[model samples]
Target: MTRQGQGFVRHIELDSRVGTDRYPFSLPVVTHLAGMGRLDLDPGVTFLVGDNGSGKSTLVEALATAAGFNAEGGSRSFRFASRSSESDLGDHLTLCWNRRPRTGFFLRAESFYNVATEIERLDEGSGELLRAYGGRSLHERSHGQSFLDLVYHRFGPNGLYMLDEPEAALSVQGCLAMMVRFRELLRQGCQFVVATHSPILLAMPGARILQIETGGTIEQVEYEQAEPVALTRAFVNHPERFLDRMFADDA
Candidate 1:
């Protein structure tokens, strides 16, 4: 039987006139999709596949904010959480998720600094928080440790989580552990939207892969057929040959 719509944000209307300058802090936008008008987002696991600076992060940030997640809480833009806005868009977008997330988490690879700061803010009133985060202050724990803890404790069934480049701090084993968690969450009807370069994460079966090209257009493709996955696979399978070709080209 066919499935029904799950109330995920299937479509979004983006206007170029709605500039980020009003947001005060502007994210790096290497690709411009302002002309796309209305773009469709898939309801299930979505892989925003693209090269660095392709504006995947920017688009995801905007969409997450539009979906009403707390910017600093892993689901919204980090900058938005630090600043206050009276704008209707921000207010209205937040209302969408007021009911509670369906199931998911947003992981930003480069925003660990903000995450650290957020933990500190949470510890302000609580004295001696070192014991709370694995017997060390959130700041005292290593970056990887903190990240692993976030995944372990924060991930739950029926939550809509968005992750941005989650592989930045994880080791091979950590990634594998994450894959296990992902499967568990998926089984519980949790949906994930991840922007990542990690082949392991991309290998999650049945994920809907969407490539956001540097040109700002988004396209759906297979994980194995993706440029990132293919290039990564080739290098891993034949690193010596790949390196030789690279050096040969330099020669």
Candidate 2:
């Protein structure tokens, strides 16, 4: 399915007026955005790849918050917060929307338990809200199982999704399954912006991979050039070589 012009988000622009002395602003990727006028989003899927502390999750969370989803993680309507640890960057981020999504969700692996608790709270009275999520509390299922259920049962066509490190809970096979489901959603006119490290998820066909360099540069890289894919491929093809180098350093 060609998702050429059906995406809700056209791009994201950072306000230059935002201060550079803050937490997220001090981050590399955020600094990059401050200088770079705007970041264009792919219509189908856009994958943000970077090492830990590179600000990928911070960016994704800000996008979700700027787009009206809860900062912790959940749909736009979910207004509960377990604790406020989100950065102030969301307030300075602006989304340019070509179209509006019919449905949407923000899934952050670290705060998913809080989102699940919010879900249970919303489902207290009638259980009707839980029905959308496969008629069970997300907390009842394993982490990976709950994620799969959200993808299969709650997510629908023409939706906008923002995910941060979804592979944190998913096994290798589960990542593969997520890729399959992601394709189905793409075909149904869904758009996704994911911050992830899984080579498996990053390998989704037609997805654009944006790599954030240590110096705060965001470059669009091909599948072979993506750090996770390249490293995984090299390690899998010759584990002994990498192991030898590591052990040699200690020797």
Per-residue accuracy of model 1 over 195-227 as CA lDDT, tens digit each: 888778888877778887654567788878787
lDDT of 2: 0.91
Candidate 1: stretches off by over 4 Å: 1-7, 16-37, 70-105, 125-136, 249-251
lDDT of 2 by residue, 13-49 (tens): 9997675676988887787898898999999999999
Assess every candidate by TM-score: 0.74, 0.96
Task: Name the 10 consecutive residues with the lowest summed lDDT in model 1.
Answer: 90-99
User: Worst 10-residue stretch by lDDT in candidate 2?
Assistant: 1-10
Give candidate 1's TM-score.
0.74
Could you tell me how far off, in angstroms, the CA of residue 95 lies in candidate 1 after the best superposition?
11
